[model samples]
Target: MPNYSEKPTIIFDMDGTLLDLAYDDFIWNELLPIRYAEQHQCSLEQSKQTLFSFYQQHNHTLKWYSSRFWTSQVGVDVLAMQIEQKAKVAKREGCIELLTYLKENGYPIWLATNADYAGLQFKLEETGLRDFFDVIVSSETLGHAKEFIEFWQILASKHPFDAKNCYFIDDTEKVLNGAKLFGIEQLYSIQQPSSAKAPRETCNYPMLSALTDLIPILEAQTTEQAEEQKKYA
Candidate 1:
């Protein structure tokens, strides 16, 4: 396949990268299963175990829990109400600057998240970041988590972006590995103090302490490529 160099695509993982939902410390650990337990009349411990098992065993399965499941399990219309209330409280720092820099540089930004469509859309909208991205790719759209390399492959096939010049920013090591396997040339791992304890398969990649740290590297690469192209021409 011929490489197109007109524009570089920078893909972002929504939850930990752009908005901080504090899933590990709060939602999964507290809010979610507790809510389910309360509504289902089960013990909190049981709900927690069930939630973990569901995600672990059905990582790629769409049947794990959609809004409907949560509704039935929690006896409330979770889909009708915004689920990102917690996200609003926990969104990470430096996201605005990162999005602005990328937007200014003409990078076609996109989001690939494991969030269900409604939840994903709600978070972006709640954060007021909906307009910054060209597209939002969800695992729900692919019937699997981004942990699988094929999810990214399918996304790339559908969106048809430049992999050689493409970049992926994510907090999950598995998703980063998947991006590498999918042929993304540039990748960044967000490092946040609150997220330091999250489980990662390997911490071998370059760690970014802040989102703004990416600007110089990407700008320098763009400049270097432009100079090299001019010399060739």
Candidate 2:
């Protein structure tokens, strides 16, 4: 077994990193347009164009991640919609396996998500993944989205984690860039955030093809660190 303390805190983004993002895509992309058309008594295309315009304006802001904000803006109860389709919420491939490995190995685990507190609670409840994490945070509580360095600063201020000694895995490049700007050294991106979407061939940071891919990287890191410590000793 590798040295447990040498393992970096594994920080994860909830929607795409641990949980499948296809469900979210369906809710926002497919179902939402239909709902908006029904509500506004407009053509489906017009509803889609209007909602898409709103989406662009708030893409990475705190409002974009909030069900309440979306509900008010779109006149659709997004939280209720999610609850109605709760059965579709699912873990990504190898999510539990990798989480179990880290939990058993005593690596600190955290979930830092742009999801709101209400959304986070229900998803955690639906997946029963709450116990595996040492810390779970929502940007709703922090008052900043993951796309900004302020989110990282506020997160560190509250949780007191070492920026250089932790790894952050997110599906969004802008969010990963935010972590990098905040001095986090180890960062990863999801190659396929939504199974419905094509896998990314390239990213600025290393991309995880599956959750289990992280384990080998951690193990190799342990070997390299041990050799470095031995050389210095």
Full-model lDDT for every candidate: 0.73, 0.93
> What is the TM-score of each predicted model, taking all chains together?
0.82, 0.96
* Candidate 2 root-mean-square deviation in Å: 2.2
**Number of the top-ranking candidate, with TM-score as the measure:** 2
lDDT of 2: 0.93
Off by over 4 Å in 2: 1-4
Q: Write the per-residue lDDT of candidate 2 for residues 121-209, one digit (tens) a residue.
A: 99999999999999999999999898999999999999999887799999999999999999999999999989889998999999999
Measured by lDDT, the strongest candidate is: 2
Superposed by TM-score, candidate 1 places the C-alpha of residue 138 at a distance from the truth, in angstroms, of 1.5
Tens-place lDDT per residue, model 1, 114-220, is 87887776676667888899988888888767877788878877888878878888887777887888888688887762553653444667877777888888878
- Model 1 lDDT-worst window of ten: 81-90
